[model samples]
Target: MAAETKQSCYEGSSVSSFQFYLERSGEHEAILRCVRDVLPREFKRTGADKSSLDVLGVGSGGGQVDVQMLTMLQSTNPGVPITADIVEGSSELSDNFRALVEKTPNLEKIPFAWNIMHSGDYEKAVQAKGNMKKFDFIHMIQMIYYVDDLADTIKFYHSLLKSNGRLMIIVEGEKGGWDTLWKTYQKELCVDAITQYRSSGEVIACAKSLGLKYEELPVPNQFDITDCFDPSSQTGERLLNFMTAKDNFYESLTPEIRSGILDLLRHKCSTEKDGRVMFDSKLSCILIHA
Candidate 1:
């Protein structure tokens, strides 16, 4: 099937825009930390110790996640070198990624390489010619939902992993803020995100169907850094507002419905028993070997 141009464009832009959000949430750090915590044990047991450790980050643009991942890797093992092969889909974002990495300390110490591979066409890169081929870990965060064929795409990733290597996918869970907002105003939210709503469950099930043993890591709301929205901060204002705006119920909404969404978020952020805006979310890491 041909790639969804409009959706792909939206995703490319969204991933670029989300670079700022990832930095702000310290989510980049949290994820890398999790990888470090589990990777060594997993690798040692799987006999990846002698093998050169390489990481392939799909949808890795602007090196936002790269900085965090590399920083965490260095802290854990300064002598241990990592080969970070980043496959970014957008040329513009890929350039930005290169610039960002240049400023990170000792990033050069590790082998950080990247290419412009449209995420949807990532299979081509994995199958490309080279000794730096395959990977110990292939990571995708908040990006898999855009693929037209989740099962085929995931299976492809599974095929690229070095023996006992892991294919990790981190997505907003079924009960996440993404889903909660959509559920609250499904009619509005569904307008623009119907595909996302429809495919969220299927992606998880797709992995299970393949017999990919996985771990569902719950990262939860964890966005406890502020109150109200700070327009200057990426996640604080843009993300919060985007979630409220994308409610197809909110977008397709008349002025009245738009106003209702605003009012609800306001109330939820204020008087709700959770004391904080309650948004349910989870992240999963699916491990496999080729």
Candidate 2:
């Protein structure tokens, strides 16, 4: 559906609403699995020397995924101290993440330094402080959409990596259902004020163009969106908002546009089996080696 003027839907979204969206859409589970699968390949200890690792978590929301990764890293290198620089914009998310760290016993093993700022802001602050801190591992988990220049941001983060360090990026695959839907309707559905939709395919191409050393891995995932068919369901409506990045997506769209989107979701984006709708919500993990 087309609007006379486009607007950002996420401006009014609350932390709880976003969390609910993640939990209901099966995104949380998929991300956790992706992190687990990708960590061992890069975070494992080498030889007998215990290594002290510095990690930079870009746009690490609420620290759920960060905590998991840190736990894995700590387990991989026992007794090795870890310094985590968590970069996040939202105060609510940062506070929630700190609270989680205080409560979780496993997270206690790793000492953390919370950089309560956006990635760019943190970089600027570090530069101002004349600190040349390099990271052993840096992860940007589905957070590049908020960045102004994805390629430049990638290059800057890559430069922050130490020798043999890994910069892991997790985003939706180009041919996945979310990517297809976002690409098709982005012009009409996305907020004009924000950057258009981005996928792992574009990031990989950027890495190749930059001549960066990288490897791509497919992360199998699916979201059961059967509840989205019910227009009156609040969960369904919120899920739609999350998917389209539009506030009240069902309500905002024109009848024809809404129908078209629904048709695409039913036939192309998802498959119906055993009376349930499952979207091929696969993710891509790009490991850029320094």
Candidate 3:
């Protein structure tokens, strides 16, 4: 028998480390706030009294945001049942999500079907089911970066919606500091065909080209990346790996290239405030209506 390789790089310590970074940087909080603010206004209630709302979550990580969205949905449509289809590629994340569900109060009100598979796999499964079901709400949060064809994926998700269904997508903005870093090093780091650094600007263009009806909002965010300047800092190295999705990313580069990148990050990508290096980490919230 052959060895079974891991499908996702988000394993064990890396997951927790990335979560720590997200927490410390307040990225998760900002995104949550943005979602809470927009979801109520953007989510369209179709057949509210006829049937339960079916939701599809692509690459839903760890169920934290999933629970939040579900709570909002339940609040919006009181006494309505919800069926959630959670598609996540990481086993660790899925397990954590299950645990979270167990601990979350009133989560039993919403039934969940967890699919430990990638988005492509979920697509195949849906196709194999002969399109028997359609979703009322669908969300893809910061997960399109791993897809091979972004536009096709978005279109496919849109196709799987019931009337008045809404698809929400979150991604980095073009003018954000992370976007500058990604554009500079994407060619070098993104060797995998499925992996690419994309911004909401590109997504908006794609949606417009497809003639899709959409609304977009900006989620202003920031992160302290000062640790990334210290070459000897383990947290710095881990943060770089998290950002670039490459192992030993900072160490692999030539000293000159590394120095140049560091200088760019310090001067162009980040601003020093109260002795902390704060990066301009803005996110985009895009809602596509079906």
lDDT of 2 by residue, 66-101 (tens): 888888887887788888888777667778889989
Candidate 3, 1-290: lDDT as tens digits: 00001256366776876686676678778889998888886553553554578999888877788888888887788777789989888788888889998888787877888888778777888889885568998988878777768888898999988888888988887778878887887766566533467889889998998999999999999888899988788888877766655567666777776787788788888899999898888889899989
**Preferred candidate (TM-score higher): 2 or 3:** 3
Worst 10 residues of 2 by lDDT: 1-10
What's the TM-score of every candidate structure?
0.71, 0.90, 0.92
Q: In model 3, which regions exceed 4 Å deviation?
A: 1-6, 44-50
Tell me which of candidates 1 and 2 scores higher on TM-score: 2
Worst 10 residues of 1 by lDDT: 1-10
Question: For candidate 1, lDDT tens digit of each residue in 1-290?
Answer: 01122233325556544554564455666556666676656555534354356778877655666677657655555466678888666666677778887888888776766666666555754457444377777877666655667788888878778876777776655655455555677766545423444224656688789887666655534454243334256445555544543313323558776666555555443234455543333444444445
Candidate 1 residue 262 Cα shift, in angstroms, is 4.5
How much does each candidate deviate from the true structure in C-alpha RMSD? 5.3, 3.9, 3.7
